[model samples]
Target: MSVREATPVTASTEPPPPALRASARSRRRRGGQWWVPWLFLAPALVLFLYFKFIPMGQAIVMSVQDVKPYLGSTWVGTANYGEILSSESFRSATWNTILLAIGQTGGSMALGFGLALLVEGQTRKLSFIRSAAFLPVVVPMAVVAELWRIMYHPTSEGLLNQIIGLVGLGPSGFINHPDTSLGSIMLTGIWRGAPYDMMIFLAGLAGIDRGLYEAATVDGASTRKRILHVTLPGLRPVFAILFVLAAVRGFRSFTEVFLLTNGGPNGSTEVVMTLIYKLGLEQNRLGVGSAGAVLLFLATLVLTICVQLLRRRRSA
Candidate 1:
């Protein structure tokens, strides 16, 4: 047998090819730039920290102390909360807030659902009308309040009064009268808020399966039956979201009440936001105001959590 010559063994001491080195460097550069997204987020973070979080922290601290402005604040340990709870005005404000939230949420959703039904089409005319109807939403709340204030002028010549007069109804005091003040404000809210709700409903309607409607029609289902069985069931998620949003908006209603009534005419229209303003700025009772704010925050948090839990349960 002939013996084969053995090849010499050697380790590969040469560097990795240039392509491998470039790829390694690129990966290192990417790892080092991991903070790029955070850098972009820094401005918003700073603003929220200064304007929102810092103020919230200060308010929480002040809730336990009697804020004396130029003078030193004195710690009172929930005394402010006690005072707020016991106050008659605060009680009234809480009741009014609940009433307004219910009224606005229901009214807006009803009106919006109706409007969505009327304009659920892909025609120029329908689109134009929908846009026109949504004008109230785009108009600033301040302007809406001012415009309604004029319409509700509580005189024979007032816009609403004139229209009612055509039907032989007498001039009615709207926001001007204590008996009707809260209702009038609530109506204003509903009118402005309905358009936003309408937009959401339109989006929801678009998401519904068109085949469902066709199948129902083929089964000789009436329009109302189709809506009840098909449209309403499909829009459950939209309804849930709209309810929360409308409720929160109603509870946070400040600009409209402040500009329109300012919690006046015997405080009939006084809501929690107006009450807080009165306590904090008008009365200079910062501690009490802070406590009220904290309570409001907690209430809102509870409401959101309850809604979420309910939604999850329903889905399950």
Candidate 2:
């Protein structure tokens, strides 16, 4: 054969280079470490199952059973649920709770976001203000309720009324009047909760890129315009988280209502938690109370899920 013909034509397909093959093998080995994430997550999964999921399951089971001290427990199906749903007291309490939640959540979020903006860039002053704001959060809720109760006393001897008197508003019934009792409780809740919201917002604000603000300023954006466009967008995640948290807190609230009003003043300040307390403790209707708790839990779960879905849509 001629020398040129002796060299066979090279095929188009060739084996991968050794380095490429080695890299592929290495990636496969590394990908096997996916179990690392699950391993790390195991503790949290266990805790959630034990504390949250298990208790919820138990509550659901208890909700369906009629429990009596002397009489044996019996399954009553949806009877307890129907009772709460049909009761006039439950309807009024539901309305009161919704109002309280709206007032508390709105007031706290607005006040907190404002405070966060005010202190965002000031390192020295931020520490002092943050500490002062968070101090109320650390105080026991019971103590806060007691303190506010004293301040909300209906008589002129009350601290709040005394202050109003100094301003010539005369003695106003802060908690005595049904018209004002729920509102007064909401004010105290706002006072205690604003600091926590402020801290969350402050953290979010701190993490926001300074370049965005600088770019807006370079474009001659007004402060309000920059806040409307940049700051709010940056805060969307924080806002979602805070909103869910505040809603849950508002729904499950009991200590303050119990201590301050005890669902009194013609049931104007009554809420689901207080209602549950009356059912379980006073009326000794354990099954009914359990049902109420289960309903509340389900409601909270639905709200939280809705908020999360909305946030995901916004982000997308």
lDDT of 2 by residue, 122-237 (tens): 77877887787789999998999989988988888899999998879978787778889999999999998899999999899988999999999999999999999999999989
Report model 1's TM-score to 2 decimal places.
0.88
Can you write out model 1's per-residue Cα lDDT over 135-209, one digit (the tens) per residue?
999999899999999999999999999999999999989998999999999999999999999999999999999
Clashing pairs in 1: none
Query: In candidate 2, which residue ranges exceed 4 Å CA deviation?
Result: 1-52
Candidate lDDT scores, in order, read: 0.95, 0.90
- State TM-scores per candidate: 0.88, 0.84
Scored by TM-score, the top model is 1
Clash counts for all predictions: 0, 0
Q: Identify the candidate with maximal lDDT.
A: 1
